[model samples]
Target chain A: MNCRQARDLMSAYLDAALSPSLRQDFEEHLQECPACTAELGSLAEVVSLVRSLPEKPVPDGFHQLVMTAVAAAHPAPRAAKVPLWARFDFSRFGRVAWAAAALVIFFGLGLAAGRYLFPASAGSTAYVPPSVTAKPASYDATVATGGNTVTDTVAGIGRQVAYSAKMDLQVQDVRAAAAAVSSLAEQNGGYVEESKITTGWFGRVSAHVKLRVPQAKFQATVDQVGAQGKVISKEITAEDITASYVDVTSKLIALQTQEQQLLDLLRQTTSVDDIVKIQKELEDVRAQIEAIKAAIQNYDSLVAYSAVEVNLSRPLFPWLSVVWPGLGGP
Target chain B: MGPQSPENREALLVQRCQSGDLEAFGELIAPYEKKVYNLAYRMSRDAEEAKDLAQEAFVKAYLALPGFRGEASFATWLFRIVANVCTDALRKRRQQEVVSLGRQVETSDGEVMLELPDAGAGPSDVLEDLERQHAVERAVRSLPAEFRLVVVLRDIHGYSYEEIASIAGVNIGTVKSRLNRARQRLRELLQDGELFEPHNVYKTRAPSKGGAGR
Candidate 1:
């Protein structure tokens, strides 16, 4: 083997990738050639040094940091239990219960729409039964009271409903419209959640406000806000979450009960080991209770206060300038 | 409670992670964090960049866990993600110059001194070793991205050509050629500093039959 051949085969030789005959020839060449031998040695040292470079220790809390980031990106789904109604074997009820439930839902939605569209006129029919309205009355009571019969309530045990409305308006001034929305929400025992005002490409001002108004004032608030400007487009949505709400509420109650039991055990336990184990379990149960409570609270608030998203924009006058030169000025 | 095999443990952890257990994913990645960090550090030669790369790799792995089919070992899959992330970062940074080893600036007195460490600060032996390591690191950093990756994988991380090929998404022949060229370039850089000399070359004994190649 010549020096060139030895140099070409150097990495292969070091890796032991050369065949027997080729390896023999390479070794023979290495025996005769000091330059090839020295070159191979230097290369080997470099490779060895590279391999021996210390492994950099990962920073402290790296796992926690990674987990924190991952959690932020993909939050853990709520561990709410499936509601009894949702898990019910509806097949045994045949199509009668399903048809009756659907009819009640449809009637309930129509009554809700009537109350929203004509608040004064729809009051008599939309009024809740005194018995149901008197029970620990909260957001869920509002849904049950919305012209739904006792039979409807029984069928809708796991049902939750959230209302939201979006309105696009052409206003003389966006700031004024935004102020009116804030005032409307405040007057109705609600509040403005978020508001943003921006000037677009044509220097036309636009304002966006997210309002949370009591379900009772949802239609009124929409109407009041819509009056601020020329109505461009309006969309109202009602999402039924009775199943999810029931599931979350039930889970919260169960977790809270478990937490209380663990707390009781923690107090009565005499053994140190048992105390420690009970305490750990209590802590876990408490955490679950807190999460479930938060979910329930979220559902309650959403059902109690409907979300009103309003977009108000000032009209542009580019056409005025084109038709009559110098007629329009910023 | 009883000692479990690594494969079974890893499979269980992966299952948990796929089912949305973040804590399980954290445990699954504990063993490979240092290796992944080192890989990133060797690629970027910047501690902060390596941290970012390592974090991104883990996050991507976590997000993509549901799609992992166990076709490859978890380590292989993770390393592949790290390699791709590093490659993207290097590509984005391509417009910027690679860090030069001995950057020099003209002084007020027109004395062009090498921009290096002060020689009088430390013990000679310790300083020499540090300087040698620093030089090697810089030389590795200065290599083209492809060559640097192949060299780091094969020589430093001790991956076989086939593994490197899979990680790099290239054929084995490409891995072999890139590794050879990278080693040659490293030798040239060491020679330029007079750190590598032809004399005192030691020959290791050839491996016995059946133990030669990976």
Candidate 2:
């Protein structure tokens, strides 16, 4: 073998790890090459020198020491004894009996308190006293236009709810569609609450609009605006806020009266600094009164008009199915 | 039966031990404790550590007695477990401190002296022999743990290659390779004049086998 090959197998040859044929080849090389043979001899010597060291026996009682340690650490059979003790006294804990009785009494008291606080939660009572109101009839038909669900009414104040349905239009300009929808709301005597445009990759743009329309023209505006593009999805929920609005309106009147009384007190004050402080306090009260009035007015506006949120996509990907609630099958 | 027919007795003890007889297990371990401890001591080169490792090995074997497949002798399996435990102990010790081949001589007066080879061996014939033996022991201790283990099993303990492989978790070829490397290393570590000297134990062999020289 060449010097390179000999070096590669030298370790294995020194280890006596070569196969018979390989061993033969290595032996032939070693016979021919003095340097490799010397190297092998040195490696072998190193291995043997390491192996010849005398072994010192363990000290006396070592087994007992280890076994005692293992016994202390593991103690396997002790666990089995626990079950035997448990079998002898299943209810040995006297305190547990008292605790269990206390738990039962506490649970009973808690149930009684819950029954008194939330009487409506108890469905077993069938007594309909005179204080209770009459049952209302359920809504039958729904006008499923755009993404809004409008219910039919016969006599009671019609609770109209409107919501905008966003869709991707296949048109060239999305801004034009947004302007058209805004104009339609204005023509219906409706006002736009919020509108914004967001830019996309490759000069694409999407428009978002929140608008309010009178309850009377709610369905008509939705139908007119929905004709713009593919409707993606919409959700509409309406609440009968007539009673809540009336309550708030009455509260607002009370607040205005309180503000007027405060103003009168401010005017009658004699001390200069006190008058200034009272006037400041009166102005604060008046500000709160105005805020209350505005809130009531806003609620009235919502009750009178319906809100629609319209999201317009740039129609980047077409030929995709769009399903909107109340716009499809039952 | 041959004087070495402890096999039948061992089998009986093993059966009882398998049945969870503690006394039987003690009996089973009693005879082999010295051998196991010596093997562990050789591997770890520490008396106290060897004892602990050997005991743990036996206990592990005791717990696993039910699963002992009788394909190999229980001694063979026990030796392997001790070897592995000793190897681990030695590795842990190496990590803790560097181990040199410095001699630790114990005197009859209960004194211990740590000295180098030349220092312990004064320029006298008796000291020379002791130094040579010490040198051989130091060389064996210097071997890599793997080759050293094979030499201990083969030469000192006289376990066959198959038994060594079983204990070492290696094949017979690996066992042979380790043995050869260990022997070669031992030979080199010996003074050149001492390499050709034979072991006294081989003197009893027939002439058909090469005559052993000392």
Q: Which candidate tops TM-score?
A: 1
Question: Residue pairs in steric clash, candidate 1?
Answer: A158-A242, A158-A243, A159-A242, A160-A241, A160-A242
Candidate 1 residue spans exceeding 4 A from truth: A75-330, B1-3, B102-123, B197-214
Error of 2 at A264 (Å): 99
lDDT of each: 0.72, 0.61
User: What would the per-residue lDDT of candidate 2 be over residues B8-39, giving only the tens digit for each residue?
Assistant: 78888889877655557767877778888888
Candidate that scores best on DockQ: 1
- In order, the interface RMSDs are 1.3, 5.1
lDDT of 2 at A7: 60
Residue A25 of model 1, lDDT score: 97
Tell me, per candidate, how large a share of the native contacts it keeps.
0.61, 0.26
Any runs in candidate 2 off by more than 4 Å, and if so which? A2-23, A36-330, B1-6, B99-121, B171-214
